[model samples]
Target: MVAYKSKVVERIRLPSRERRAAALEEAGYNAFNLAADDVFVDLLTDSGTGAMSDDQWAALFRGDEAYAGSSSFDQLTSAVADVMGFERLVPTHQGRGAENVLYGALLSEGDVALNNTHFDTTRAHVSNQGAEPVDCPIAGAHDPETDEPFKGNFSLERARAVVDEVGAERVPLVIQTVTNNSTAGQPVSVENTRRVRAFADEIDATFVIDACRFAENAYFVTRREDEFADATVADAAREQLGYADALVMSGKKDGLVNVGGFVATDDGALFERCKQRAILYEGFPTYGGMAGRDVAAMAVGLREAVEESYITDRIEQVRELGAMLEAVGLPVYEPVGGHAVYIDAGATFPDIPADEFPGQALVCELYREGGVRGVELGSFAFPETDRPELVRLAVPRRTYHREHFDHVAETAEAVLEKRHEVAGLEIVSNPAVPELRHFTASLEPVSAERAAAADGGSE
Candidate 1:
């Protein structure tokens, strides 16, 4: 096989680590890319799906096709409606656009958006459309790498905080199920969801759910946690789904297939408005915003996603990996929830100052040395000042094996061997014009010349 190089002759950042430091040539680095055949685990993105027989997918295809192939958007919407159990189905071109376009029509400027956490795109979209993204996660309620169950539900106090700040009339709250991405991938509790939704109603605020990792979140709450220990996974998921005014999920995560997302709601007006925007960006109101095969795949994926066995195993797996990382002496987040394992880069490289963007440095290091390309959670993904530094390792559905996890453990140990080499990132510039740009930050360099000097190689 033509080999992909694994060694890093230069400094790099390890994603989901302390900081995005530059790994020195002296650090004995290797890349973490799967293509390089070096990385053993991929816990950077929640893109995993349970495996199935070809017949299963084919059965979904029988009911749906990959492309519309001249099928009307209404037909698409009907299929989606049937799949999601909604009263009226409308699919459109809304996912790729900003939160403003999707929500601006329903909300005015200065409106409040409350959620346990905000995915990068959703936050950018909401802010671009003139709404404020308010994140109030529950207290110490989660650990992402160990499947600790639901610890990330929004709080009644936090809800009251929103009502206190924006008043009930102008504020609408959003609840994200499963991993509270910004808060270490924690799952929100069903009880928390019930309370938050009830509070929103009390204050006359609309409650929306972000179901990007809903299935994984369900696994944690139903199969793992004490409160939900008696409930079936599907029952818990349906209950969570029932609490929201509407729910939107990223297509790549639990929704089956690698493409398409859905926004479910009972509000006819909201549905109408979202469909109008969806047609502009996605396609038509009937199909919302998806292609044919993906539509079929998602239809099937959604059905399978609700199954307890499929989701439970996947959610548990991430926790298992996180526990493994913790066992090896890495400072992993406690109370694993769903999807990713967040590494405390700040804790990992405490000697490295926060100003240095240690998490960024760590991410770069992991990539260079291990060829793995997980994303950085520090300011690289969110604002560093507002939140603590972190490196996120998302686990895509059905993407890796146990061996991959082992490789991650290996790279982590190797990177720790050169812990002193990790450095923090300094933001060079930040502009907020386009909504999605919020995720990737531009930064100043750190590890190059210092490592050269340390090794007595070159300046």
Candidate 2:
């Protein structure tokens, strides 16, 4: 791979440490509530936080601000068809909006929606529709230390069991999240996609893909998968997407855009159904929920996201950060993923009880220590699940350089060095509704004495 020169062209001022701490306290310990200016190194998510290229910015100016049949939408349609191999495009505001429309159209009450693993919003949307969201990920997916090449793959046995128990008729669709976020951002291999596609076909069920990180997933397939070892990233991506009957994308991610998403399919009937919902919930069929400028930016972003050099640089930055953390004796998920490094909070803070949310504690400490923001993928994120607590540091594409990652790693090391001083947090208030409570959950640090007692009592 060839190296490309880049430099930061924009700057923002950060708030004082005292202000940041007070902001965290006022926001109920939720990093999302902190002002953007207070964050020194924001790693909250890769979605919609990436820096667009000059070409994308240039396209934005060319946007035709029409409510119907916009030229910008035409560009997006062409790009989606060229890269994703989909025959129809149904745009939406973002990935979750696409999920809402697609699930609303296909799923009925009590229907089962199976996936390798359902990320937070996907699970919430399925559950909100009175449908069941079943995760069939390989057993290794839950083990942060597991070195499985494709930890995000759906287990064939588990998939079969779900079908047998739920009945084929009750299964609406099977989803495959590329670079499965819920499973440490691990990539689902081409073989796994083929297997799932075949199985879904056998059951006459739709095989849909959550393609938010499809570009990164494709890069992994080319580099890691034997069959695609010699293929280009674009070729690998096209082949991987070919296995899906339909796909939903968050343009904020792999599309390399600031904001946009779409649901694409080849089935005319399904497209019509999804289109109706898109119009009803999002906007007109042409622009969906995005403006013409956003559509134009997405068109250029989709093209750039598949570039070999771009993805190689992006994944390497994440790996560099993971190495930095691991060198400090932090327990990080092995076989570093495409977009982020996941810290095993359970292992790192073994004394911090799960119910108290060790992951949440770690997240807060990172912010307070260095104004660095990250997200927890632990019990708080999935209340009923027994998955190990994890803290994810998601790297935005083209937004930060190596220096920024080094700073974050240093902050993580600082936090780890003082791990014994940290105390877990407890929810003081929760959303009135049970679905997706983590977003608005009000949490406070557990009393220092109680935390000390729990630490002393733990093995």
Candidate 3:
């Protein structure tokens, strides 16, 4: 049992069916555009959506909002050192902020950065810096039903080929995202980490660990990897980090705080470069873009995230939800994942083509059917790329209980029953939008007549 109590509650209002339809139309069928109040169960993302503990709340009281050299920063650095074993910490507003600072400082025009898989924002940041981002996920990563213990493992063979093709000097960075978010929230093995680090060393490339759900990933390693079967999640995590020269973390996920992230490295010169860039784009070197209170809260959350009981509960809850989704006959990704259950939208709607965005349609129908929100992780998220059509139901940490998952399963079942009736969505927004168009892209049902049949459609 979790050794914590809920100190507060927020009432959730399930909007009427008519209101949901209206909200869908108003938001142009994009779940990201929906107002928080309009949705009943928000699964859009697990990022910064988790409930913090009383200790985290108490840490906020000790925040010292100094202009520079704040004690809160000191606390955050100490926590990062204790849990992550990194000597230097450069705080940022969030994960992407750290990415911008690190990538901006490290990458140059025409350079190449490789990863097991690059989440949307991570890819964008690399491209934005005029560099190329290459994904080398293991084979069958795109196959939703493929049973693999560590589906998140980076392909050493592919990495070697890329290094040979691009020439090692052109590839400056090699990263591995723990609990790889793009394909599925699958955990990476320590063995894979070790190999990737050795390969990076061979190519004289900087090996970085892109971690957000690091603790959850470590828990999975302990449960699945034989060598770690007797090891604590905390020790496994430290071992995983030991292989990386640096780490870019979104403290929002594992930190269990509402907002905060950081880049940790032992490379003093590289750390100095990131600090300079951080000051330009984010904030001061000490606090980054976050407040002292958030920094302090993140410090407590980092330690709490690796606790055996906390990690076990977190991963178990996600596993139970995945089983429930599978019980409803949903084609869920095999072995589940760390933070979310990904539904195979392609299998769910065989008739819906990739260009039409079947995943987005599923998310829209899910909201309309039961006021549940999910995000598409397919053609829409990674436009022009060949990837699995998936809709991710990301569960926030320590927030909802089994009853909430039951409701989500029921909602998914309801949508699946009338799956054929669901139509695909076409992007109607301006094509001039950024590469991450799913965030702001307006989309409409393909069949104008069918859309017009609704009370409020194609507005």
- What lDDT does model 3 reach? 0.91
Candidate 1 residue 328 Cα shift, in angstroms, is 2.1
Residue lDDT tens for model 2, 1-459: 423556446675566778878989987998777778788899999999988888888899999889999999999999999998986899999999999888888888889999999999998888888899888989878888778888888888898998998799988689999999989999989999999999998888899999999999999899889999899989999999999888989999999888889999998999999999999999999999999999999999998888888888888888988998898788999889999999999888876889999999898989998889999999998889757799999998887877787788788889888998788899998986565777889899999788777767764
RMSD of each: 7.4, 1.6, 3.5
TM-score of each: 0.80, 0.97, 0.96
Candidate 1 local distance difference test against the native = 0.61
Query: What does the lDDT come to for candidate 2?
Result: 0.89
Q: What would the per-residue lDDT of candidate 3 be over residues 209-327, giving only the tens digit for each residue?
A: 99788999999999999999999999999999989888999998999998989999999999999999999989999999999999999999999999998988888888999999899
TM-score, candidate 2, is 0.97
Q: Which candidate order results from sorting by TM-score in descending order?
A: 2, 3, 1
Which pairs in model 2 have colliding backbones?
Answer: none
Candidate 3 ranges with C-alpha deviation above 4 Å: 430-434, 448-459
lDDT by residue (tens digit), candidate 1, 322-371: 87778777788777547788888887887666656677777766665555
Candidate 1 accuracy as TM-score:
0.80
Evaluate residue 227 in candidate 2 and report its C-alpha lDDT on the 0 to 100 scale.
Answer: 98
lDDT at residue 124 of model 2 (Cα atoms): 86
Clashes of each: 92, 0, 0
Between candidates 2 and 3, the one scoring higher on lDDT is: 3
For candidate 2, the per-residue lDDT at 39 reads: 89
